[model samples]
Structures are given as structure tokens and as C-alpha cells.
Target chain A: MSGSRLSRRTFQRLAAGTALAAPFVRGAHAAGKISIGFWDHWVPGANKATTDLCNEWAAKEKVEVQIDYITSQGNKNRLTIAAEAQARAGHDIMAMPSWEPHDKAKLMEPLDDLMEPLIKANGAVNPTVEYLGKADGHWLVVPATAGSQIKGPCSRIDLLKEHAGVDIQALYPAGSPPKADAWTMDAYLKAAQACHKAGFPFGVGVGGTPDSVDTAGAIFSAFGAVLVDAKGNITVKSDTVRQALDYYKQLMAVLPPDVPAWDDASNNKWLISGKGAAIMNPPSAWAVAKRDAPKIAEQLWTHGAPIGPKGRFAPFVPYFWGVWNFGRNKSAAKSLLLHLSQASAAEKMVAASGGYDLPAFEKLTLFKTWVEEGPPKGTLYHYPNPYNHQVLSMAGAPAPPKIAVQIYTQAIMTKMAVRHFQGEAMEKTLAWAASELEGFMRT
Target chain B: MADIAVSRAGTVNGAGGRTSLHRLMQRKSTVAFLMALPLITVIVLLVVYPAIYSLHLATLNKSMERFVGFGNFTFLFGRETFWLVVKQSCIFAITAVVFKALIGFVVAHFVHNIPSKGQRKWRGMLLVPWVIPPAMSTLAWLWLFDPSYSAFNWILALFGIDPVPWTGDAYWARFSVILVNIWIGAPFFMIMYLAALKSVPEQLYEAAAIDGATWWQRIWYVTLPMMRNIIAITTLFSLIVTFANFDIVRVLTAGGPLDHTHVFATWAFRVGIEGGDIPLGASVSLFMVPILAVAAWFILRDITKRGNEA
Candidate 1:
């Protein structure tokens, strides 16, 4: 009985298991702090400055705010995929793209649970039904700050006036900015052609992606063409397709020798370096040049995307922040969403980060002088953009386009336009492209 | 004696005789299997279960909550995007493997020709591309393809040649990507082939040369014939990796300048993960199975046949 009192091995096994399991159990329940996940160092308004601000907010609230930062550097495509995986695995609260929130409805929490008052406050949510809140009838997302806008006729006003012999102030007058609204594909071709003839042969950027496609799409959509229905259906051919092709071929002849080889950040770099004039880009172009390249930045002028033939129109890409669906702390997630989405926070973060031109939230205030201060001084003030209620409504329309519009657009981009630029089927391509997209839409 | 017998009986009967299952489990193998129980449980929980679950997902509609039963597969057959993806995956896989194998073999032979000490030195330095993690290496690839700031263009400029649209044009983008894959992959084949080359008895080459074989004939008769197994194995491994290459295409072009460069994996992820068409994504991912299986079957058959012949 004395010898068999207790087995030493059994006691050792029990003690070892207890030691390992105790910490894990303790870790699950002991969290009194909140983690705010953000795109680290990738974009401004949500970087180290934002991190410091979150810390400041936490200190004021007497709570701990742990920020888990990630960089979107080379993993842009994987961002959406990773988010879905994280959601299934669980995201306490992560910031993501506007379109992503709509796609990843299942993994996020409704902001209604976070701060119900903000949504219903003065009926702001009602007026901006598709504008500010949930798209799929689920309150899974909230517009954190002002929308992100680009498609600027970001130009060297000094260069355009200097090289092309155009007046900077008059073309863009006191209140109404010229070349700001959508114009015909022909108008765009003429504008570029006129610039080229004036001795800026390699005038516009055409690395064939962001610069080329943006300009091309601006023409395509402005002509009231739809490439894909909003529901993700493919449409190939349209009249808009033909018109865009005809115009691009005309425009391509005057583009620089290395136009095909231009990189994504090239036009921005060229515009900032003062090597080129009148590159269309996002508002960040103004912001970045203002900070890094002051001379070019000072020469910077911003404009909304040029209006298309169907009246002033451009693809309006909406940007914002939202609460991920499944979070550990529900109330805290909503409160954070409300606080961050506040006009105050957006402006502060924008000022802190300093590259954004448009705040998705309407409340942000950055007038002509916002770009004139400090490093962002005189450089960003050269351009003024006015996107009003009318412009907003058109860009924000909810309905998907009809079928005929889709087909024509596809033929233009995929078959004709791309092929034309490559010198494969230059002559016959435009007519075929026009009829194809239009025919496809009708079918 | 009776008390001793009773205690001994208790030792055998106390826990073991409780049930037939318990009685059967009383052995060294049973204890060994019992120890592996947690791992087996984890394999079922994480790997086996998800595989079964993914098959279930593939048979459903968009949301995956509703059952459609092979509807997704049937739908995929008619979709143009699905066929394009299938063609793209094959071209990507077949082309990458052949190039990697050919380039690797040539490099391996060159590396083998050096003195043993020189061979050791070159092998270590040559593996720099393969040794560095792929993610780190891909950044360099991205910079090379950068539209304006391309290092490739910078070099091309030095020679007074026009810069190619390495990533802008659809064909050029595919070319740029496959070239990068070759640069990173060839060394792996080189290393494997070199090891196989060294493993070949010097006597075989000597014997072949004695048989009046020239350099090309020696290589054909001695080198390739000797290194065939290594070549086959390496190509099969590369086939799986290159076919399922998501990182290079994703980071560099993202199936864009208009979806011309998309493979099955990236397209599936776009539809499934990004687009939230989970069932569609799952179904798309299933396209990789038959190709991967065919490559696997060829490798296994060769390996087993070698064993049997030996």
C-alpha cells in the first residue's frame, strides 16, 4: 500500500498537460484590449499617423488599441482572397476596399450593431441608400470616410500653357472647370491630337494599362457603353466600342515612341518629373507630387475625369472602410467604424497621410488651400475638381447595363482596341468592333 | 496461491475484459495506434474533412447553402471562361516544365564539367535563386516588368534597342512571366541533374569514349540515358508547381490588361474568394485535379518500373 500510493509518471503527465492548457484557456478570455487591423504603410490616412492617432484615442478612452498592420505592396490581387480566408478564420476588425465589403458580406458584422444612431442620424442612410451603407440588403459595411476619386486631367498647367499654347485659367474658369466633364471620344482624340501637333509628340501616357485603359474606358463609358453588366456578365460589342477604337487608333499615332512600354507609375512619375504634360490620374498624383517633387507639384493642376459624349461622365470608383462581419467584439467594432468614418477622422487621417483628393464621406473639408500647406504646398493647388450631386447620382446608378452595351464594349477592349494598338488588324478592326459590341448587347 | 491467482486474474480482466473492443486493443500495435490517435484526428479534422467538404461545395450553387448536384460542373463545361482557363493552365504548365528541364539539363552538364572542387563551389553559388524564398525573388521579377522603371528596359537602353512591352501586351506579358519562371526554376533542375550527373560512374563516360563516341554521342548514350530518372522526376514536380503558379501571375499582371493571362487557380480564386461565388470557385479549382493526377501517375509509374527493373 505504501509503495502503490501514487504513480510518479501519472502525476508528471497530469502536471505537464495542465501547464500547457492553462495559458491557452487564459489567452481566450483575458483580452480587454481591441485590435484595429489596417493596411500598413500601403496608403496614407491609414498608416503610422493613423496608428498613432488610434493609440491616442485609446489612451484618452483608457483602453488599449492594438493595431495589426499589413502592407498591400505586391499582394494586391491576393488582398480580396486573403480577406475571405481571414473572415472564415475570423477578423476582429479589418479595413478593406469598398467593393470587397459588398463581396464579402458574410464575414463582417452589421454597423447597425456597432452604432445604430450614426446610420439613422438625420436620415443620412436613407438619402444615400446605395451611397453610404450596405449594398446587398445587409448592413455589413459603412463608408468610413470620403470616397477616393481619380481620373483627373492631372496636368502641368504651366507645361500645357507653355507647350500647347493654352490658357490655364480660362480653359478652367472661375467656377466651372473646362475639360473636366465627359466629352466625345472624338473630342478626346482632338484634344490629344492638338497637343501632339503642338510638338508634344509623346504627349499622353500609354503604358497600355492604367493610363491607356483609363483614357479608353473614359471614352467607352462616356459614350454610354457598358462593358460588363453590374452583375458581372460579359458584354463584348457596342457602338461605343467602335467609336472608342476609331478614336484610340487616331490618338495612338501621336503618342510617344515608348508609349507601349510605359509603366503604371510612369505617367504619374512623368507628370511629377515634368517630363510630360496632362496625364489623367487620381487625386493622389497632386498629393504625392506636392510632397516629393515640389517644382512639378507646384505645376500640378487637378480636374475630374473628362465628361464623355453622353454628357459629363466617367467611371466613378467609390472607396471607403467597413467593419468585417464576424468579430469578437461587436459593439466595439461598430464604435470604431463610426469614429473612423467620421468626417473628423477622415480629414484628420487625410491631413496626417496627405495623398487623398476625395473623401467618400461628404463631411471632410479640404479646400484649395489644403494642398498649399507645408510639403503639400503650392504644388497641389494648380488643379481644382468639383464633383456635385448631379455627377454623383449618375456615377452611383445601381442598375446593370443592357446586354447589347456589354458585347460592344468587350469587342472594343479585347479584340479590336488591343489588337489595333499592337498593329495586327488596324483598318478593319474599328468597324467590326463597333458592330460586335452593339450586336452583342442587342443579343 | 489462490490469492495470487485472483490478483493476476484481476490484472488481465480489470479493463481489458470490459468489452470485445477493449480485448482486441490489448497489444503493442494497439498502443502505437492509440498514440497516433491525435494526429489521425487532426488529419481528419483539417485535411480529410475539408477535402470532402470542398467536393460538397463544388456540387452546389453560388452561396453553397443550396444543393445543385453537378450543376456547377455542367455549367462550367459551357462557359467560355472555363475553357480559356483550361487552355491557359496547360500551356503554362507544359511550356514551363519543358523549358525548365532543358535549361536545367544544360546548366547541370556545364556545372558537372568543372573539377569536383569547382563543381562544389558553382553548385553553392548557383542555387542563390532557388535558395532565396520565392516571394523575395518575385519582387525582383516585378521590377523587371515595371512599365517605366523596368530594369530590363534600362539594360535594353544600354544596347540602343527599343524596350519591349514585357507585361503590357497580352503575348508579351505571358512571355515575360514564363521567362521569369524559367529563371527561377532552371536552377532547381540544374541542381538535381548535376547530382544525377555526378552519381554517374566516370567509368561509363570513359567506356563510351573508348567505344569511339563523340561529345554529342557520349551525352546521348551516357549522360541522358543515365540521368533520365532524375529528369523525369524533376519535370513532374515542376509540372505541378508551374501549373498551379498563383504568385507570379497574380503579383505581376493579375490576369489583366484584360484577363488574357489568367490560369485556373487565379481565376478560381477571383470567382470563389473575391467574387464570393464559392461554389463556382470550388468547381474551378477542381479543374487542376486531372492534370496534376496525370503528371503524378507518369512519375509514379516510372519510379515503380525502375524499382521492378532493378
Candidate 2:
């Protein structure tokens, strides 16, 4: 044997000793390590912007950071959140979809300290964010800019003007506050009817999907319809709800007959196929159209939702960055979140998302990305609610979250409308909704 | 040689009480069990443990903080949607399995009678549906049933027919989902019955022919009697799978049009995963076990009976 070679037993002993000491060695260096799971962005290069921002922060802070772009597709992000919360392990930070921060509030680290400073720097946070991201007066997560989106009327500008005689650009003009007083539910129904007669119907779905529920929620909110109040009382039997249902019945008649079966992608597909005058959606449809069919993309305009008896309401789904209480490097996680929430980083994220992402802070809403993105210039100018023309609301809000989540996920509002549209008696539909709301309250 | 003989004699004679376990381990049955240890360990860890954990989960309340002991079950029992799901799950499983078995039997007979040289190509083509992942194929089906751009509707429109609501109406949505399941599953039954067909003795058919039996009679008397076990087992398997189906319904309808098409699996997913009520989801899923267990019991008992008869 060579003099440099060790005996087999000695070699095995040394390997075993090293293996035994490895975790301790890792523990010694773990103080500066932070891992975060972000919602995988739909827009190309959006994830890279967030990654670059994180890398910049990590470099300045001398911390090692790992980032995971978790997709919300197939509920994988929610599944990851549930698994991490159950195991008390996984990433130090995770991007929580709307209602998820409330769902897992107990396991999340209260970020009042991180959020308060950001709130101070970037004006007041959106009330909808405060409603969903806070539990018992403590902020459980920082409102995220990566996946946050406002679902509004993304219309075919040419089709609306030519067929429906409603010019979207004139109503919500670029570089100015919306001249939207004439944009009411009655006008929306008239436009829908006109568009339907023109064979390019409005593609609004009343199915039990998130898009369907969100659209229904906004309409219901606009009519001041509350299925369950904040204090957990069932309110489905009110006149407001009945009025909302009646409006939906008229609206559904103008929609394609197959809308009841539509999934989340159905509306997007409907718009991109050039068969629909408008769809209630994020900029995803417009973005997809931009890539696949530029002609259709150039005509697309995202503007404010129509007004109702109470007010104009837009469906807002805000993603949040939550720190798990059991995370190893919480200090680093909080610092990284604060850094990302800053105006400069948030603006970069919104720009990268092609003006699709909406920051939760009021001050950050004026970023030029919304005004600048277009094939037809200023096509997305009204996307981020820069003029605050509409009330930003989530479906199933005002109810206690535990009940509201059921209301949202069960798609009660849409289902009730569908039941009524399918020729069920109005009273019968209201009773069914009342029963469902009761069940939600009971559970 | 003498020591070996002595050891063997001692094992057979139960000569040492301390070595009883050692002797037991040397037996053929014990050796077979040891050979199966890895698989048993795997099943115990993966299948049995998760099932038991899910059962435990079913008893807990929504938050899983308190043991509610059947509270989730009671809650599900009271909800109208839950009852609808139960009815829908049964209808989906039974109806899909029946059609799948019937179609598979007819197709298998055709394949069996075809020229042996061409059978391979036909079988491969038939098996394509089974081979492709259901998720990928279902996405294609989703496109084919797209509300605005359905290929099927386009074809119908060519013949002056109004576009059919393939997945919009509650009845049509149920039909669409069941049709997709049968399309994916019939191939599996075809291959199984094809194997069973090959094993049926040709002489038995000849014997029936000599007795002047018709083609239908031959099949009814000889072929069915022989393939009964395989049919029972395949139907049982398809029943279990169809009852617990999630992908087709989830991808197609997502239990929409007012929860008209929700099966147990999809409804459970909606309530449990999406709704963030894991305990209730577990309870919903646990309801599947009794129906599946009853099916398995009847099918297995018949198989066992036929085994004993043989």
C-alpha cells in the first residue's frame, strides 16, 4: 500500500464522523440563509425582475437567498402553503394568494413592524388589502406586487365603439380621470345586448370558477349586495341581492349559452378567439392576444367596471408575501420583503408584468407602466385604477373570512345567478342561497 | 453431513424451545414472506398509513384543532351540494363503468377475430387513449369542448346544426365527463379481455359449434363463463377509479353550472383544498371507501368462489 493511503476502516470511520458533523456545520452557517417562494408570474420576465431585486438585496445584505417561483396553477401554491404550514418547514417566506393569508394566519409571522414602515413610506395601503392581509389587527403578510391584479372590463375598443356605440377610450380616456358617469349597469346591459345582436357577445362566465366568481362578486358589490355581513349574518334575502340577480339574468341572456360551464381560461380563450366584444379579466388575455394575434391585441382596452346603485366596484385579487413563524431566517425574510415593497422595486415588478400587477399602496398606483404599455398607445392606462374611479373589492368580502372563503370557493353568487337564469323562481333561488349561506355559517 | 442432518432433525422435532423462531424462519412460507417484506413495508408506509391518517383527519373539525368525531361527516350530510355530489358520484361511476365494459367487450371481440398479422397495429392504436396521460388528453378534450371554439360544434355547424352545448348544460356536462372517462378506460378493459379471449380454448368453441350452437350462444355459454372473473375484476377496478375520478371533471366543468356535475373527489377538493377545510375534504373523500369496499367485497368473493371451484 502507498504511504499516503489510509486503511479502509479508518477511511470509513472518517466518513461516518464527517456525516455526523455535517448538520451542525450547516447550522453554524444558516444564520444568513433565507428561502422565499413567490407566485410564478404569468407575464414573461416578471419572475426575473423579482429575482434580480432579491439578488440585489442579498448582495447588499451579505445573505444567501433561494427563490422558488411557485405557480398558482392547479392550486399548487395553496398546496405548498398548506404543506409548509402543516410541517412547520419549507421556505422562510411564501407568496400568499388572496384569502390564503387569512386561512393560514396562525402560522404566519405578524409583519406589523415591516408593514408599518412601508405604509408610512408608500401612502396608505388599500382597504381591501388591510381587510384580507390582517387578522385581529396584526398584519400577517406584506401585500405583494408580483401577482396582484385588478379584474376589470378589458374590452375590444373598436367593437364597443362600432357595434355598441360606446367608445371605451372616450369613457376612460388615457392620461386623465375617467369620464364614466354614463357608464352604468343599464348601459353595460345595453352594450351587452348590442354586442350580442352583432354576434360578438360579451364573454362573461357565471360558472363556479374564480374568474366567474370574481366577476359576479364585483357586480354584486356594485349593487350593494351582501350575502353575509362582516359580523356573520346571512343577508342573501335582501332587495339588493335580488336586484343583482335580476341584472345578471339580463346580462346572462347576452352572454354565450355555454358560459355556465366555463372555467377560468374560458374567458381568456373567448377573447383571444375574436368572438367576444369584452371579458371581465386581468391583462392576461390582452397579453396572450399580443403574442398570438396582434390585430386583436391592439384593439383591446382595459377600463373601469360599470357603475351600479351603490358604486362602481372592480374585483381586486392581491397576492401577499407572508413569513412563516417557524422560518429560520425571519429577519432576512422581513428585510427582503420590505425591500421588495419599496416604490422602485414595486415599479420594476409592475413594468415587467406589462402593467398587469397592481401595487397595494395608493402612492405606487401612478407608475408609468400602465400609461405606457400598448399597441394602441395607452391601452392599459386605466388598468391599475390610477384615478381611483372604482371601489376595489374582492368577492365574498365583508363577511367573516372563514365564511367568506366558503362563499367565494363555493361560488355562491354565480351559482345563485345561474339558478335564477336557468328558469328557477327568483324566490326559490334566494332560498337556496340562504340555505347555502346558513350552511357556511353553521360550519 | 451429520451436523446438517442433526440440525434438520432438531428443527422438525421441535427439539429446542429457544430456536423455535429460528426454525419458523426457515420454513418456505416464512421465506416467501421475507421475500415480500419490501413490498409489504412499502404498502404499509405509503397506502395503509395515509389511509389511516385520512380516517383520523376525517374526525377532526375544519381547523383540525379539536376532535369533532363525525362533525365533518354530519356537516357534509346536511349540505345540499354534498348530497348532490354523492348522487352524481354514484351515477358517474356506475354509468361510465357499464359503458366502458360493454364497449370494451365488443371491441375486444372484433380485435380477436381480425387477422393476427394486423391485430398488433389495431391493438396499439386502440391502446393509445390509455397510454396518453389523462391530464394531457383532457386538456385536448377541453379545447375540443371549448365554449367558443369547439371543433365538434364547428363540424356540427357545417351540417346546418346548431352548436351543441357539450359542457354547458348540467346533463351535457355530466355526459361529456363520462364520455371522456370511458374513452380513456375502455382500452384498459379491451386489453384485459383480449388476454382473457386468447386463453379461452378453441376446442370449446368447436364443441359448441358441433352441438349447433349459434355465435351468440357460443359466446354466452363458453366465452362469458370463462371470462367472468376478469370482467368482474376489471369492472371493480374501473368502478373504484371512476368513483374517485378528479381530473376530467376538474378540467372540464370544475363542478360548475351550480354544482351540477361535482363528483366526490372534485367536491372534496373544492371544499378541502381550495376552501382550506382539510378535515371536511378528508371526510368527503372517506365517504368513497364504503361504496368502493362493497364493490371490492362482492367482486373478490366471486373471484374467490370461482377459484375454489377450479
Which lDDT values do the candidates have, in the order given? 0.60, 0.91
Question: Which portions of model 1 miss their true places by more than 4 Å?
Answer: A1-35, A41-64, A74-93, A106-132, A136-140, A173-188, A197-217, A228-237, A252-264, A324-328, A355-357, A361-416, A419-443, B1-53, B157-160
Worst 10 residues of 2 chain A by lDDT: A22-31
Query: Model 1, range A174-256, lDDT digits (tens) per residue?
Result: 34435433233454556566667775543454433434544555555555655555554444355655566666667778765
Each candidate's DockQ: 0.11, 0.59
Candidate whose TM-score is highest = 2
Q: Compared with the true structure, what per-residue lDDT tens digits does model 2 show for residues B77-133?
A: 888889999999998999999999999999999999999999999999999999999
Cα lDDT, model 1, residue A74: 48
Give the C-alpha miss distance for residue B44 in model 1, angstroms. Answer: 7.2
After the best TM-score superposition of candidate 2, give how far the Cα of residue A188 lies from its true spot, in angstroms.
1.2
What are the per-residue Cα lDDT tens digits for candidate 1 across B231-301?
88888889988988887777676665545678888877666655446677888887788879987997989
Top DockQ prediction, candidate number = 2
* lDDT for A432 (candidate 2): 92
Candidate 2 segments exceeding 4 Å error: A1-31, B1-31
